[model samples]
Target: KLDDADLKKGLERSISTDIQFLIAGQNSDGGWGWWRGSESENWLTAYALLGLHEAREAGYAVPEDRLARATRFLERWLTRTAELQDNATLDTRAFILYALSESGNGDESRAVELFDRHTLLDTDGRAFLLMALDNAGEGQRPRVQTLASELTARAILSATGAHWEEQAPDLRAFDSSRRSTALVLRALVRVQPEHMLLPQSVRWLMIAREIGHWETTQETAWAILALTDYMRASGELKADFSYEVALNDKVVLSEKATADNLSDPVMLKVGIAELLLEEANELIITRVTPSEGQSGMGRLYYSAWLRYYLPVETLKARAQGISVARRYEAVDAATLESLGAAVSTAQVGDVVRVHLTVNAPNDLFYFTLEDPIPAGFEVMDPTLLTTSHAAEAPGRERLDPDDSPFWYDSWTQSVIRDEKVALFSDTLPRGTYEYSYLLRATVPGDYNVLPTFAYEHYYPEVYGRSEGSRFTITPTAATE
Candidate 1:
């Protein structure tokens, strides 16, 4: 129902909103940080500038003043690195150079001079420098060819496709082999589109996706750019083909696609009740060939997903790469003594502590933990005052001598919600961590505690959870 004009307007509006947000987050120094209000950093600022430049090239109206200020910040950063002789990584320097060149604010001769100073360069560093030179209209230079050749020589080729790997320790959290391969592929597409490894490298990136997209945002962005460049260079955008989807030897759907709808996705949904069988069921997809003397060219990509749910109690504990375990213990409010791990019953005015233990076999990024509490208990917020009855209870003054109520070793943020306590961390190294928080048994009732769950924010496949528990609270002597 929508036409080209409608799509154009929608895209423009989206870009305008994004530009406004990016400008609003820019610091007074004209640089960006990992998050708003944080100290500005070099790499994040360069990444933002590159995005703005690309937006402008796509015919979006970006404020000239904002771009100029960001450009000056990057220039100052590069100058400081040289003046102080800081051992900045080659990849960082190369990326900054590429961004400045794309914005038409870089000196080609100086960039080349800096590039020559680095005797050793990683895969990312070489790719960025090649793109920088290409942006500066020096793509045909001898030095550029040398860099391109070196990259091609070091590629990891296989029957499936070709790719490059990243071995830098500092970039492990933010970078991966897919990202490195995408960047190198883009550079090669610009410098030598006829190279023998181009097709295989493109294949590698296409098949490396987790499902519909790559692992991280950085990886997805670079992969899209690389594939777009390859498409333009090879004139492979047009398509004329028909495909059929068959389930259990019966055709369920058939469709034709042309250049206009080549980018659109075709979805087919069938209920399990209709397709479920006691024996194995097969679903097959086939591309219909053109008539005699007709030809079809291009690629077809598809993904199949099966969705289902099960009862919480039926789900057993699983640990792909990370594991979590939780326990509860009742404690005396006055003496601060441990009352054992069994919290099956507690007095109405007693305090209970919830402990969570997590173990990671390898480094994981953007980790999160959620532990749901029983309705009969109320989470203790350290910032608020305790109830009057608990405050007046004997030995209550000795509960916290230093006024510190929580104990956690490795978490960036912790939040207490109405029914659950959540903990978050940007990165968790390989180790064991324990976190504990206090709760008060305010109401008298029997309640069920939900399971404690934890997982990597980006890759949900790596996750773990603990079994649920139950507890009961009895009325105090005064209430009884």
Candidate 2:
């Protein structure tokens, strides 16, 4: 229970720090910038406000003054757009309407006038407006309900469409004057939360991971947060990892601050955490974008390596219970029922769970029915038994194929030789994925039986192929 408080305290500290960046981001035009300057961008201002609001809800202590200023910036921008007759800007209109709707300004004269009946029906604008209405508890209105059904239908059909080619709404269109279809997901996920499709925001994140773009620890952190948020909301897990990079004994990120480009901005996620990181003393990402030169969008790590070590070391400690925290292994769920991480020595009647940031292609990671392992949990191999030996340990009973009838393998004709090497290979597909698996205590044993990865494939060397991790399963007798 206290963990929630502790996490909240940390989030508050982060929220407190992020307010400055967003405030400083306002331009002379009364709107925020993509970073700190260039222009008073309305879209950036809107997203910044949205992000800060989310932070506040997450229990981050965002300042009321900052919120007021940001809200005013949005209001002014909306008022200016209406006066100028440029209400066709899908992203801006949607955002402004959302701001107005969410703030109880829907009944206000300005908001009533801003809701354009003609353009509200436009696909992009309609989706965005619906999101605002939904949040405003006005989605039940005839117009809002119609759009909601339409989006829910789109979300359902997302699985059959030409995903890579079909263009969706792009929020990033406001920036760099280019249409980045990635933003469409922001609207889709918000309005159709119950639908099964994976959010595009998550898919972009998954793409980033699939491409191994998280070389620096900064990239890794953002990716973790984004993936975690998407997965948490989706009510399912992505069985595969979009990307994985090797970690040497050195720091996980570059020593110097990164350079940003128009193609890749200094802030990728566009959230309060990104803003908090931008203000840090040392940055996790060192590759600067073009915006960094003028906008000052890079983020830094305060403790240097402490944050880097937290999640990773937690994972390394699971095998022997070296760390009080839990570490989950990554499991591939191709053709399998539902594969998750395991705690060693766990029994048939316990619940095994995993904690991970995942982005499956769509809703590929979930099933309508519960997995089949509930009757009596039997680990395929707590050790992920890649290697086998005929000789049994002093306490381990001999396997005559009768006692170990559940055991599987390549061929029974060939006499088993060595238990020292992997029997077969589990090929990872070409795309990238990030995953974590854990066996919960309800699955039954006091101790965990962790598995080990035996194969070795350099991740940094071959970005085109799959790489696997290994671990050892030590059965600690159940304490209860």
Candidate 3:
């Protein structure tokens, strides 16, 4: 909403309730994840802190300890990542800067230095980058203005104004496309409110179906916030004109606003008025002007605004995160040969080997890998889990175990009742861990092996799934 809107007491209460829910979802680590019950993520934690800051500024009661812990978590994250010098994605860097700026922290300057070293290609990345730079400080305004112009230049104009392609070629992914458009519109409007593209973008947004009530919370929130600010700034909400309210073609009330006499600006507190509002209502406003012919000509443009609130009981918050893991399946020659079976083809009573590999690019706790033993197969021996050396990547500098004693050990556990095999570690560093297990085929049949999933063990949110492999077990030939 807008400051001028003077949202009714009821609406304000609803907003307050939502804010409380957001505050309660903060993780024990003083950070927030994308969804409830999710492990702390830097960007999500930033988003939560920003919302809390807004609520606190708006005269709402926010716990000081919550904010302090979140700030410390963010500062610690920045220090650790910088020391590692890992190749951080553009979105991550932008979000970190945004968090620092919005938190009233002095480290925003450092975040700005990190943000300046990259060129963001994705629309989401660039839009957030602009937002981060804007919040970074007054000193960064010049850069923000320049980047806003660059992004505006890249926007692809359409019949409905401008939109962004998903990547290079795919323009049909309209959800993400619209989200990007909204994000860019927000950024550009902040830096260049008078830009020529404003009307086209605003017009396109206005005509879209349920533009303000998008399915995704982020899209909906961004759209509503952007449009409200734009409309308020443009003076489209003037209350000087006469207005009347009606329901089902029946007149309810009429008033002629005298803008000069009113102390308040264009804001109208219509919803709070005593008029009995129905499930649906229509309002009409007319502005009259004197013409050269000495006759008054009236031009009427009707605009309708609706506000809907869901009962707190109906709102359910979910936590979300990204899982990263890989699977490598191969027959264990040693185990198979121990049973005197051929090495190339699997048969009844032959041992099958599976090597589940997890790539932990980010710090993880209780990182878990879960593999379901395929049907018709039974565990032949204990599981083997080990960590030798982390996989090397192009730009990542792998931490040496000798240098940093905080290394992870892989441990395997099998639940016989659930027929599931799991490998987990207490603290997984930014590297790779492997889990291998052997199972003996008990029946001769072709089977579709289910995919194995791996995720952060604390939150248990899946990050990756293995590509399933199929194997045919042959019946042992009758002895001649």
Candidate 4:
């Protein structure tokens, strides 16, 4: 039984911790990167600035110097990009303008100038620009209204809900269609809360969520912001309702909700064995009318998830959004020459290069690849100092740049574990990429190599895997 005071204190503590982390990660250039120690980027800096500004608005303490430095970085970035007239930077420019406006440092004239220069902007970019104009106190301006109308006209409405689509590639790894729609929703909620499409847009956002969460962190944050604004504008916070859940015409659960417990979730669990039928199972939810003169208000949202598992061998390689294939090649330990492909037999100390080919038809963020090795083989740790035949020093096995079979840019980080090699990237653009790592046959035995798998870290629905294989490592002639 937590009270509002407890929740507020917890939220403030979390905000304070996040603020300290952001401050500690600020680069020397008064900006942020995809991660600490990476190069500082303009949009990343603006994002951090916006976070700090929101914290300050919420009564959290934010260092003035930090805010000033980040503001200067965005200002300088906007000026330089404007001089270059790079159309590709339109999204960045609009986002920076919005950040500046939210922090009370925006220039209305400058925002108008940017809008004039970039007449053609993507959905998210246009939304940001609209937000900037609104924050700059130009929400009623003719041009601003025109932009808002254009956005409203582009809304894709269905019987159940409405949403906007993004045609341009995302500016950052975390950007997504959900985030773009959420941004547009926020802009409309602020500029025209009474618009007929606003409620439908909010419905679309709610429906698009996977369970209770969005696709990415950025999408979730923006969606929450948009939904919060919509709730406040529409006065949809209070709840007073009774609902019942039925399974196969049998009442399973019933509950009444009120304003005091509107945020609480009603959950029901049933074991598979308890199911009434193996197929065509029906679960229904009904909103019950209040007795006597009492009335019902607000809405009830529910989600149902079916959990099951299948044999590992029954699962085939899936290429719904991403595909991955792996092959093994035996190579000369001394000359680094390829001996053969799909080499199943190798002498002790032989080097085997495991190659993974990944094809992503669309841009993906936070992708990871995992390749499990046979127990008889040991990974060649590139970070270690070793003289083993397979443990070639980093940068020693060089190949012609044009003739190289591996794509080095596919991954930003890698780990060599005892039985697997894992590669990770913040973003994987639409293309085919090949990555390879070395392994040495050590123990003499027949071993099974587990399937190599890859997937988007945040959205596991997009995933792929390769077939497993067997390998045989023989003892050296001298040892025999």
Tell me how many clashing residue pairs each candidate has. 1, 49, 6, 0
User: What TM-score would candidate 3 get against the native?
Assistant: 0.49
Candidates by lDDT, descending order: 4, 1, 3, 2
User: Listing every candidate in turn, what is its Cα RMSD in Å to the true structure after a full C-alpha superposition?
Assistant: 6.2, 24.9, 15.9, 5.1
Q: What TM-score does prediction 2 earn? A: 0.37
> Across residues 1-52, which tens digit of lDDT does each residue of candidate 1 receive?
2357878789789888988788888999999965566668787888788888
How does model 3 fare in lDDT? 0.59
Query: Candidate 2: how many backbone clashes?
Result: 49
Question: Candidate 3, residue 237: CA error in Å?
Answer: 2.2
For model 1, the run of ten residues with the poorest summed lDDT: 391-400
lDDT, model 3, position 329 = 41
lDDT of 2 by residue, 323-351 (tens): 11223333333322234544333333333
Give the winner by TM-score: 1 or 2.
Answer: 1
For candidate 1, what is the TM-score? Answer: 0.75
How displaced is residue 207 in candidate 3, in Å?
2.8
Query: Candidate 2 regions off by >4 Å?
Result: 1-15, 25-30, 34-39, 83-90, 100-124, 152-192, 196-209, 212-234, 237-480
Error of 4 at 326 (Å): 3.8
Question: Worst 10-residue stretch by lDDT in candidate 4?
Answer: 392-401
Q: lDDT score, residue 6, model 4? A: 81
TM-score of each: 0.75, 0.37, 0.49, 0.79
